[model samples]
Target: MIGVIGIIISLFLLMYLAYRGWSVILIAPVLACLAASFAIFDGGSFHMLATYTEKFMPALAGYIKAYFPMFLLGAVFGKVMDVSGSANAIAEFITTKIGKGKEIWAVVLSCAVITYGGVSLFVAAFAIYPIGAALFREADIPKRILPPAIALGAFTFTMTAIPGTPQIQNAIPMTFFGTDAFAAPILGIVAALIMLFGGMFWLTHVEKKAKAAGEGYGDHKNENLQIMDPQYLPSFVTSITPIIVVIVANFAFSKWILPSFDSSYLETDYDTSFKAVSGTWSLILALILGVALVILFNYKRFDKGVVECLKDGVQGSFLAVMNTASEVGYGNVIKTLAGFSLVAAGMLSISDNPLIGEAISSSVLAGITGSASGGLSIALATFSEQFIARASELGISPEVLHRVASVACGGLDTLPHNGAVITLLNVTGMTHKECYGNIGMCTVVIPAISCVAIIILGSMGIV
Candidate 1:
C-alpha cells in the first residue's frame, strides 16, 4: 500500500515538475530516488539505494548504448538530406508537379511523403518550411496558414497515424511491445485518414471564415512561381533514394530476410530478432545510404564547401539530440525506481480483465509521461512480467495484448507537452492557442476515438 501511494505521488509530482518546465530527466530521477529512499528507510536501511545505483548505472549505460546510436544515425541522415539538397529538391519538385492552384495540397502532400519516409519532425519542418513559405507566397496564401498546414501535414498523420514510420511516436512502441510495424496497420491507416480529412476540413473552414469577413486571409501573392536554376537542383531520383533504401531495407529485413535468418540461424523470440533488424544494423544501413547518397548526388560539388555544410547541419542538430537523449535518463529513472512498475501493478490489481487493465495502465502512464514513446517504453518494460502472467491466466493471447498496447500507444500517449509538439510550436513561431485546436484534435480527440475503436475491435476479436 505504501509502495503504491509513493508511486502515485511520485508520478503526480513528476508531471507537475514537467508542467513547470523542469527537465523530466532531472525531475523523474530525483523523485524516484526520494521514493526509493522512503521505501528503503521504512524497511530499515537495507542499502537498497547503493544497490540500485550500482545496477541502475549500468542499465542506464546500456540504454544509452542501445538508443543514442539510432538517434545519431537518424541525425546524420537528416543532416545529409539537408546538405545534399534532397529535402528541398523533393519539396520543389512536388509543388511544381502539383501546380500552384493546389498549393495547400502540395505542401501537405510533400510533408506527408517526407514524414512517411521516416524523416524526423524537426528535419521535416526545416526542410519544408522554405518551400511551404514560398508556395504560400506564390499562391497568395497567408503566412499564418503555412505554419499550421505544415505542422498538420508533418505531425497529425504520419507521426502517429502511420505504421512502420520510424517516427519515435510509432516506432518506440515496437521497441517496448515486441510488436511488428504491421501489428495495427489498419488501425493506423484508418486513424491517419480521419486526421488527414479532418485537418483539411478545418483548414478549408478557416479559410472560408476568414475570406467571408473580407479580411483577405490569402490575399498576399508573389509572382515568383518559377523553378530556380538547374545548377541548384538534384535529380528527383537522387533525392528519393535514401527513403527508398531505408524502407526497402526495413521491409525486406522484417518480412523476408530477418524471418528466414531467424528461423534457420538465430533465436525464435520476436524481441531478439527485431532488435537485430531494427537496432544497430538498420542504423548502420541508413547512415551508409545517406552518406553514399550525398557523395553520389554532389560529386561535382564536393569540395571544402560540402564539408562545411555537413558540419553545420550536424552541429545544428547536436543540441536538440543531446537534450532529447538526456530526457531518456529521466525515463530510465522512472523505470529503475519501479515507479512505472508500481503503477502498472496497481492498475492490474483492480481489474481481472486484461484489456481494461491495459487501457487503464496506458492512460495513466501516457498522462504522466506526455510522450507516446516514453509511455510505451515504460509500459513495456514495467509490465512485461505481468502481461505474460495475465495472458496465461486470462486465456488471452500475449500478441493480442501487445497489439492492443501498441494501438493505445498512439492515441492516449501524446499529451500537450510532448517534445515534438513543443518543438513544432517553437519552430513555427505559433503559440499553443493558435495550434492547440489541431493539437487537441490529434493528441486528444482522435486518440480517444481511436482507443475506443481499437479496444472494441480487439474485444470482438476483429483485429
Candidate 2:
C-alpha cells in the first residue's frame, strides 16, 4: 500500500519536475530511487543503489544497443541538411512560391517539410526560425505564435504522422511492436490529416484574432541568430532530392528488397523477430541513404569541411541517445518496484483494446519523462509483452500497434517539461508564458485528439 503511494508520488514528481525543467538524467534516477525504496523495503530487499545498477543499467544498455546507430545516423543526416543549406533552400522555395500574404502557413509548412524529411527537431527549428521569423514579421503576425507555428509543423503530426519518417519517436515502437515506420498506413494518414488541418485551423484562427487585436512579432531583433546568405544555397531541386531519396529508398527496401533476404536468422527470440527489426533496418538504411545522397549532391558546398559536421553530429547523437537511455533506465527501475505493478495493471485495464491501452500507457510515460522517445522506450520496455499478448488475442495488427504508440508519444510528451519544447522556445527566442499555450495545443492536444480518432476508426475497422 505504501509502495503504491510512493509510486504515485514519484509519478507526479517526475511530471512536475520535468515540466519545471529538470534534467531527465538527474531527476529520473532520483525519482526512480524514491519509488523503489518503498517497494524494495516492502519486498524485504535493501539493495538501494544496487537496484539502479542491476535493473536500471540493463534497460539503458538494451536501448542503446538497439538504437544508437539510428541516433548517430539521424543526427548526422540532420546536421548535414543544416550545414549544406539543403533544408533552407527547400524552405525558401516553398515560402517564396507561396508569397508573403500567407507567411504563417509558409513558415509552418517549411518546418514541417524539413522535419518530416528527417532533420532533427532542434535543427529544424534552428534552421527554420530565421525564415519563419522573417515571414511572420513581414506578415505582421505575433512572434509568440512562432513557437507554435514551428512546433505545429516540426513537432506535431509529422514527428509521428507520415509513413517512413526517421524520427526516433516513430522508430522506438518498431522494435517493441514488430512493425515498421510505415505501420497502419491508412490510419496514419487519417491521423496525420486530423492533426495537420486541426492545428492549422487553430493557428490560423488565432492569427486572425491576434492580428485584429494588434498583436505583432514585436521588437526582438537582438535575439535573432545570424544565418546563411541565400546565394550559396543549393537549388531547390538538388536540396529536396535527398529527402525524396530517403522516402523512396525506405519504401522500396521495406516493401520489396528486405523480404527477399533470408530473415529466418532473426527468429532467435520472440523479441528479435523479423517484424521487430525490419523497421529498424529499413529506417537505418534509409537514413544512411539520405546522408550519402545529401553529401554526394552537395559535395562542393561542404568546403567548410564534412569531417566537422560528422563530429558535431556524433557528439549530438551521443547526448541525445544517452539522455533517452538514462530515462529508460529510470523507468526500468520503477517497473521492478512493487508499486509499478499497480500502475501497470490499472493502465492495462483502461481498455481491452490493445491499441487504446498502448496509447494511454505511452502517453502517460511520455508526459512523465518529458520526452517522446524516452517515455516511449520506457512504456514499450515495460509493457510490450503484455501488449503483444493482448494484441495477439484481440487479432490486432502489429502495424496498428506501431502507429498508435508512435502517435500517442506525440501527445502529452510535448508538455512544457519536454526537452524539445524548451529547446525550441530558446531557439525561437520565445517564452513559455507567452508562447507555450499555442505550442501545447498544436503538439499535444491536437495530436492526442487525432490519436483517439485513429483508435476509434481502427476499432471500427475503417483504417
Candidate 3:
C-alpha cells in the first residue's frame, strides 16, 4: 500500500513539474531518484537499488542502442535534404500538382507525405513550416491556420495509422501480445481515415471562418512568399534514400536476418529475435546508408560538408535522444521500486472490470508522463500480462486488448515539456496559446475518436 502511494505521489509530482515546463528527461530521473530514496527510507534497501540497476540498465542501454541510430540517421538525412534542396524540390512538386488555388490542401498533403515517409516530427515541422507559411501568405489564408494544419497533417494519423510503420508506440504492445504489424491493420486504417478526414475538415472550416472574420495570424506581408524556384533542387530519389533504407532494413531484418541468426545457434523466441535484429544492427546499417547518401550525392561540390553535417546532426540530436533515454532510465527506476506494478496489481485486485482497470492505469501514467509514448509504455509494461490473462479467461482474443492499448496510447500524451512538442513550438516560434488548439485536436480529439472505434471493434472481435 505504501509502495503504491509512493508511485502515485511520484507520478503526480513528475506531472506537475512537467506542466511547469521541465523536460521529461530531467523530470523522470529526478523523480525516479526521489522515488527510490523514499522507498529506501521507508524500509526498501540498497539491494533494491542494485536490482533496479541490473534490470533497468540493460533496458536503457537497449533503448539507446535501438533508437539513437535512427535519430542520427534521420537527422543526417534531413540535413542532407535541406542542404541539397530536396525538400524544396518536393515542396515545389507538390505545389505544382495542387496548383495555385488549393494551397491548404497542398500543405496537408505535403505534411502527410513527409510524416508517413518517416520523417522525425520536429524535422517535419521545421521543413514544412517555411513552405506552409509561404503558401498561406500567397493564398490569403491566415497564418494561424498553418501551425495547426501542419501539426495535424504531420502527426495525428500516420504515426499509428499506417500498418508496419515501426512507430515505437505501435511496437511497444507487440512486446506483450506477440503479434506482428499486420495484426490490427484494419483498426489502424480506420483510425487513420477518421483522423485524416476530421483534420482536413476542421482546418478548412477554421480557415474560411477566420478569413470571413478578417482575423488571421496577424498579417505580415513578405515579397518572397510566392517564390518557388528549383535552382537548388537535388534528386528526389537521393533525398528519400534513408527512409527507404530504414524501412527495408527493418522488414528484411524481421524476416530473414534475425530468423537465420536465431535458428542457427540461439534458438530464441520471436520477441528475443526481434529485439536482437531491430536494435543495434538495424540502426547501424541505417546510419551507414545515410552517410553513403551524403557522400554519393554531395561529396564533390560540398567536400567536407558531409562530415560537418554528420557532426551537427549528431550534436543536435543529443538533447532529444538523451531526453528519451532518461525517461527510459526513470521507468527502470520505477520498475526497480516495483511501485508501478504494485499499483497495477492493486487496481486489478479492487476492480475486476477491465475498462476500469485500463482507465485507472492509463489516466495515472498518461497524466504523469505527459507523453503518449511514455505513458502508454508504462501502462503496457505494467498491465500487458494481466490484460492478456484476463482476455484469455474471458475467451476474448488478446489481440483485441493489444489493439485497444495501442490506440489508447495516443491520447493526451504530449506534455507541455514533451521534447517533440517543444521542438515544434521552438521551430515555429509559436506559443501554446497560438498552437495548443491544434495539439489538443490531434492529441485529444483524434484519440477520443480512435478509442471509441477501438472499443466498438474490440467488443465485436473485429480488431
Top-scoring candidate (TM-score): 2
Clash pairs, candidate 1, are none
Candidate 2, overall lDDT?
Answer: 0.85
Pick by TM-score: 2 or 3, better one: 2
lDDT of 3 by residue, 1-463 (tens): 4666776787788767766677766567657766776666567664445544665556567566656665666566666655555555666678668988688778777777665555556666777778877777667777766767776766667665565554555555555676644346677778777877877777788877888898755655442343335665665666566556656665565555755663433334433544333434544564466556646775654535667766776786676566666666677677667566665577677666453465456544654566655666667666777777777776667556655666665666654555566666766666778777867776567766876776666666676
lDDT of 1 by residue, 317-366 (tens): 55544444344444555555544565545688886767667766665666
Model 3: residues with Cα > 4 Å off, grouped in runs:
1-9, 19-23, 36-59, 179-183, 220-229, 237-262, 268-271, 274-304, 335-367, 392-403
lDDT of model 1 at position 112: 82
Whole-model Cα lDDT of every candidate shown, in order: 0.62, 0.85, 0.63
How would you encode candidate 2's per-residue C-alpha lDDT over 1-463 as one tens digit per residue? Answer: 7898887898889878866767777877788788878865576464668877888788889989999988999899999998899999988999999997788789888988888888988899888998888888777888898889888889977799788788888888888777777888898899989988999899989989987988887898677466577788899999898888888888887888997898876675453577667778888899999999898888878867988888888999998898899889988888777777888889989889988888999999988888888888888888888888987887777788888889998899888878889898888877899998888889989999999998887776654
Cα error of candidate 1 at position 408, Å: 3.3
lDDT of 2 at 157: 76
Ranking by TM-score: 2, 3, 1
- Quote each prediction's TM-score: 0.78, 0.95, 0.80
**Better model by lDDT: candidate 1 vs candidate 2:** 2
Error of 3 at 152 (Å): 1.2
